[model samples]
Target: MKVILLERIGKHGHIGDEVSVKDGFARNFLLPTGRALRATEANRKRFERDKDDIEKRNQERREAAAGIASGLNGKTVVIIRQAGETGQLYGSVSSRDVADALIAEGFSVSRSQVDLANPIKNVGVHAVPLHLHAEVAVSINVNVARSEDEAARQAAGEDLTAINYDDEANEAFAAEQQAATADLDTSEE
Candidate 1:
């Protein structure tokens, strides 16, 4: 059957697209779910009006996504995990982790938007691509670092503080402060 999509059925198709599908499938799924309508003259005209509105809304969304992409460009996100001596992670970093990192950084992004082919296994810097829109993709830096403090605490069998993996600069600064304090204590002898 020929139908005009009222909403996007999948990732690619837009609203008001004339697509061919089986009548039974359309009746059972698409029509009932309000994903499409029969391509009659009245519905076609209605679709024409709705198309403009949909396009305008999509444009606004694209613009907002672009702005977010701009803000995220060249920004580094850190994820600290337990690793072996060779830097192999105990567990890999998944899209959900990346999404959570982005969310913590004040960006509202979904896991589905992340385009990672496989979970990160080794610790280092990785370029992660985020698919904000169909044509809009932006690459963000992800640094997976070994949780040194966590590892030390675990080795000594002490209670480990929950390490914040979102900020690399803060962690670096904290290390520097600790070193400075240690130096002052040694010099005060």
Candidate 2:
């Protein structure tokens, strides 16, 4: 389907530009979201008539997004969650969690704006992208860990997931000797 975009849609077209897109995309997303209009003669005339107003609104939104992006970019948020010994999270961190963390930090962000490709299932720092506007994008660090101390350590580049073989072996040996001592006492009694 051919449509006239009302604003800049990444990879599609800029405002007032006629472009071809999937019919489902046009009808379901673009039309419903008011981001575009069907390419018809009357719609073309309407677009030309109201093009300036649409462009002005788009510019205002872009500017606002840019202002927010300047302050939001490269910021870090810490999220504490239960994890296994190997640094795997008991529950994965979703987009909503990241949005909430950002909100706690006094940033006005939504889950839709957070472009997380997949839920984070490990404890570490992750760079998450935020699509603030059609033209404005920025990234912030998400520090996921089991505790605040772990988060700090992760931020400082410590690998909490590494297993210490010497400690484990020493612990096992101590446990075996304690068990043997208990058994000898029981036999004597």
Give one digit per residue, the lDDT tens place, for model 2 in 2-65. Answer: 9999988889989999999999999999999999999999999999999889989999999988
Which prediction has the highest lDDT against the true structure? 2
What's the TM-score of every candidate structure? 0.62, 0.86
The lowest-lDDT stretch of 10 consecutive residues in candidate 2 is 159-168
Candidate 1 lDDT tens digits, 49-104:
78878777768878888998988877778788887766678999999999999999
Error of 1 at 134 (Å): 1.8
Best by TM-score: 2
Model 1 misplaced regions, further than 4 Å: 1-16, 19-43, 148-189
Among all windows of ten consecutive residues in candidate 1, which has the lowest summed lDDT? Answer: 153-162
